[model samples]
Target chain A: MGTFLIVDDDESLHKVLVRVLKLEGHKVVGSVYNGSEAVEFIRNSKTKPDIILMDHRMPVMDGTTATREILALDSTQRILFISADETAESEALKAGAVGFLLKPIRSADLFRAVKSCLGEK
Target chain B: MDPMQIAWHLMEGTNDIITSINKDGTFSYVNRALMEKLHYSESEIDTLSIGTIFFPGEQKKIKAIVTKDTHEIISDVQTIMVTKEGEMLHVEGAFSPFFEGGKKVSTIALFRDISKQKKMEEDLERERNQTEFLIDIMTHDLANIHQEIISMLDFLILNEDLPNETVGIIKEGISEIERATRLISSVRKISIVSKALPDLQCMDISLALLRGAIQARLAFPEKTLKLVTDVEHGEYFVVADEYLVDIFYSLLHNSLKHSKKKDVTI
Candidate 1:
């Protein structure tokens, strides 16, 4: 089991991801509306999560910035950026994100991606 | 010139039908042209009040005219009027006031039959509405079908192991779905282009192409693919919709599907 943080502006999509991940036996650490908030939550929290599912387009600060900051804080941080933005995958890669998932994401794809990020088979 | 003779000459020369009415609603005079158009006799016109000639519930309109400040009222107003043979003529008219030295004298109404024009306008409106409805259905319904086909292909790729022949058939189905989706996209593009120029944003084209290639690769793992970025760093930017990058992704997928050898370049 892995602890994951979901960062997305869409509440419906966040709920869906949480439900899917929980069903797959992953513990959801928390969820926030944007990248900046995700950064703040990670800073204050005593426990670091196994994975972060971040969205690209956010109101204040984007997934790329958050990923860069998180990795700066700890280079070994595992982060996956999820976005409807078609340009997300490479951007996430450049920012040192582990992987990228597209929006309207399938449950199976999400499972595979989360497992991949967590270094699980 | 006498008042009646002047009125007669005015009506005879103009295309419009003219009639004069007293404040009491009695017809003081109707020109010969008007009499011929209505097929009414001089004696009959003289016996009827101007209000009696109007179709039912037209007294309110006549009252409006009497109370109006303008000396001339030219309106595309619709109302029915009674002919000598008791036929109802759908008419649109201009009603004007006649005055003698600042004292109210009469009301002169000029009218034309407009039933044919009204019918044509209604038919044109209906056709316009139907065309819009059809376009809406085509955009939404076809898009849904395209999405469903893509989803089914994804499901098949993930869960099922099939023979080479079955895989070939699935690839063919994907091609068909791609064709249909392309057609819908072209229609949507035409509409957007016809309206106003789209506001383009500067984007990294090479990165977009790479992401699209990666997505295509993930979608079709069986196909061997090679992507080379010929674009220079930061120089790869172009002005276009960020979402429009999907077009390149679709094109790459199509190219990969048809490549003879295992290796394909985008």
Candidate 2:
């Protein structure tokens, strides 16, 4: 079982992702509401998660900025960008995200993304 | 040099009523124009105080100008003054300090009736305020109904698991409502924003464009689509609102739905 952090502004989408990931037997470290909180949590954590599922658009700070800051803190952080907006995929890739998942994300697609980021088949 | 000669010259030459008051407020000089306008003789004018000719509220402002130690000028002050017949007239005036050598002597005020202009300005201001109030009520209050309808449709799309036919009907209904709402909202927003437009914040434009393309793909899953992104390595920021990105997403969704080709590029 791998630990993962889910960050998104939408509460409903966050809850859905948490439920689905939990059902997949992954240990959910935490779920946060915005990119800034995700950065703060990652910076202050004693142990980093195996993977991070990040949303692109949020208030205060966005996923791209959070990704850059988090990677600055720990270069080995594995990030997967998940958003409803598809245009963020390449930018997320440039920001060092291993995978990109669009909104209304299927369970299979999400599982595959998380697995891909974890370097498992 | 003579008081009567000075008074006669003033009355014959100008329409203005020339008057002088002593330090005790008794009238010292009154022109023929003054007597004709007020129907008061020179003797009657001398017996009356300067304060007696002022309207109740005008006394305060007049007193302030009169009692100042140094030379002072009051310009275009609008206030009411009373005639000898006790009729109130709205007037605008300039009050200047009169000086003898280095000492303050008296205050001389020249005034004109401005009741017509004052009434016109008040009417114009009232109309302007009423128009603004009506517009605010329509946009802020009535526009919320459209927003609520959009929110409800979003909820339905996210939560409801209906048959394909029912989903199609609901989606069509949502599209029609959105179209009508956009038209009304745009008109209202244009009027409101024209009055006061907010500053835009810098945003990542490429990210928004990419998100718009992805949302289009999701909206039409049956269509084979290719979203070609050409975002540079460095930061690509532009000034815009995030809500506009969602509008672009909606436009792309419409394009994808209507496209006849097997492969559509965004």
Candidate 3:
């Protein structure tokens, strides 16, 4: 199990995802509303999350911009983008996200992605 | 004044560019409309040949029109005419051979500007293409997302130890999203049919319906749904595509899934 952070605009998504990951025995580090908030959380928080589930297309800032800023703050922080828009795939990768996953993901797949970030086989 | 002089004044008053070109392809007479359109004085036009009046690359089409021998006037021939500043002017007109004293002397042609009309047509085409593209993306991508949402909700319901009330809410959410997905797919199918009308072909629709029935039965092995059709077996031809089968399958599926009866004829 790994520590994970959730950054998405939809509060309902955050609730369901947090509950699902928690049920799988992963630590729920924090939740941020958008890219800018995620960057702020990463900067201020002393204990950084092992992985970040970043969502593309948010109000304050988007996942790509936040990922770039967060990576600058901490180069090794693992960030995986979860987006419904496939058009933003290239931008997500360019911003240094480890992977891109489309939304409505199963809990098992989400757990698997978290494990992968933790370097599990 | 002679009868021909009065006729010339009447020709000059019309909006269209009227010109009479000699058999040698030189301008015999260019009306006031023609001179105004190209910003050319009568003396300037007198010095220019018919070939010089039209830009190159239009020569072949112009030649075909000028050389054709027919008693009837040929209408709707599009040609490019050049302005004084060398700008292309789009025009459509009729070419009629003029005769003098029982001998063919020149070809009389009338040109009307169609540039604005063409531009409007092009804009409408672009708008239509854009709308189709957007509908396609919404149907394909949005439906996929909706499917994913339902899948997640189903898994959560199955695996989680949630309260009965919470599970009820989740199930309700799932049904609503499914309905939304079906509506989107229906709209997308409509757009697809409109955009792909040319792909329609004549085929035996009976075979397609039978296949749809078999697929529907396989999809719902537990449900007793009968596919009822009055189509004969010889050859029921239909100008359609694979989507026709999908339409039948969806109808059968929806009928069976919604009806309260254990055995429903669809």
Candidate 4:
């Protein structure tokens, strides 16, 4: 399992995700609230997560902007958008996202999509 | 400058074939643009009729517009014509009647080479013909690969005699894969229907949404439905076409498939 950095606005998701991800033998390196925080974290941090789950909606910055900023910092960054919004597909794809897990993503899919992005599958 | 001098300069400078033909369709005047593109010298092309460029039997269309009464400008349209090297070139432009004394004595035609657009269209048509091959890969070939993972999961769960908890998780994973495959099949059907480009019809969209929820229930037996409309339920007429139900099915399925919550409110 790969190390994941989750960027979602919903605080409730952080606990549930950690519980589900830890059970799958994956590690959650960090969790951020908005796109700006994610960008800041990625840029300033020493150890980077293997895959990032970017949320489509947020308070300060959206996932697409965060994805763009992170990629600009490091082109090899692997980021995904797990969104419930149907209209997010085109925007997510346009932002150079590697994969998208439509919400409410099951435990198995979250694992699979992460592994796929990590080049494990 | 004199009128003839200005006319000559305009004809020679533009990036189009400008030629005036006689009433009998024999070329009377040829511009530099025409000579350059058709690879014909001025004197040689003046002897050639406009009919020389027309594709075989298609010359009759030009010839039929013989009299002043029948003369009209043929506007931007695409047609095939033989170039100087006998290569078929797609030309897109117009042809207009030239009058000497308020009576049409000849015609002047302007055309630009459009072989690039024609080539692109031909390539697209070729790819479009391979739709069945694409569908085959999406459905049949892809399913084979998916089945391999499933069979491996099955072997591990059954033959190896794993712990009950581990086996249950494996089964859950397999079910997820199965769900994904079913989604792919549904996507394929919808993709094919959408590509066919059905005509749009006005219908009660609220009714369609209600019917679509019913369809989703039928399609996925395990999934429960609780469709709530933001608007009051009534005859909500909308400009939509076929597969209105499929649209709702896709939207409704996404929420159901991934939601950890028992009761969804979308």
Better of 2 and 4 by TM-score: 4
**Deviating ranges (above 4 Å) for candidate 1:** A1-121, B1-10, B13-15, B32-39, B47-50, B55-58, B69-90, B133-150, B160-266
Q: List the residue pairs that clash in candidate 2.
A: A85-B211, A86-B210, A86-B211, A87-B210, A87-B211
Candidate 2 lDDT at B137 equals 49
> What are the RMSDs of all candidates, in order?
13.1, 13.5, 9.8, 18.6
Residue B157 displacement (Å), model 2? 3.9
- Residue B66 CA error for candidate 2 (Å)? 1.7
Where does the lowest 10-residue lDDT sum fall in candidate 4 chain A? Answer: A101-110
Would candidate 1 be rated incorrect, acceptable, medium or high by CAPRI criteria? incorrect
Q: Give the range of the ten consecutive residues with the poorest summed lDDT in model 1 chain A.
A: A101-110
Name model 3 segments beyond 4 Å from true. Answer: A1-121, B1-10, B23-25, B47-52, B55-75, B85-87, B97-105, B154-179, B201-239, B246-266
DockQ score of each predicted structure, in the order shown: 0.04, 0.03, 0.09, 0.01
lDDT of 3 by residue, A67-113 (tens): 99999999999999887655578899998998887655556677778
Model 4 lDDT, full chain set: 0.73
Tens digit per residue, CA lDDT, model 1, A1-121: 8998888776766666666677778988888988899888788888788998887777798899998988888776788876655436788899998887654445567778887777742
Q: State interface RMSD in Å for all models.
A: 6.9, 10.0, 5.0, 12.4
What 10-residue stretch in candidate 4 chain B is worst by lDDT? B140-149
Poorly placed runs, candidate 2 (over 4 Å): A1-121, B1-50, B82-88, B151-266
Better of 1 and 4 by lDDT: 4
Query: Residue by residue across B207-252, what tens digits does model 2's lDDT show?
Result: 7877777756655555777766678524688777655566667778
Query: Which candidate wins on TM-score?
Result: 4
The TM-scores of chain A alone, one per candidate, are 0.93, 0.93, 0.95, 0.94
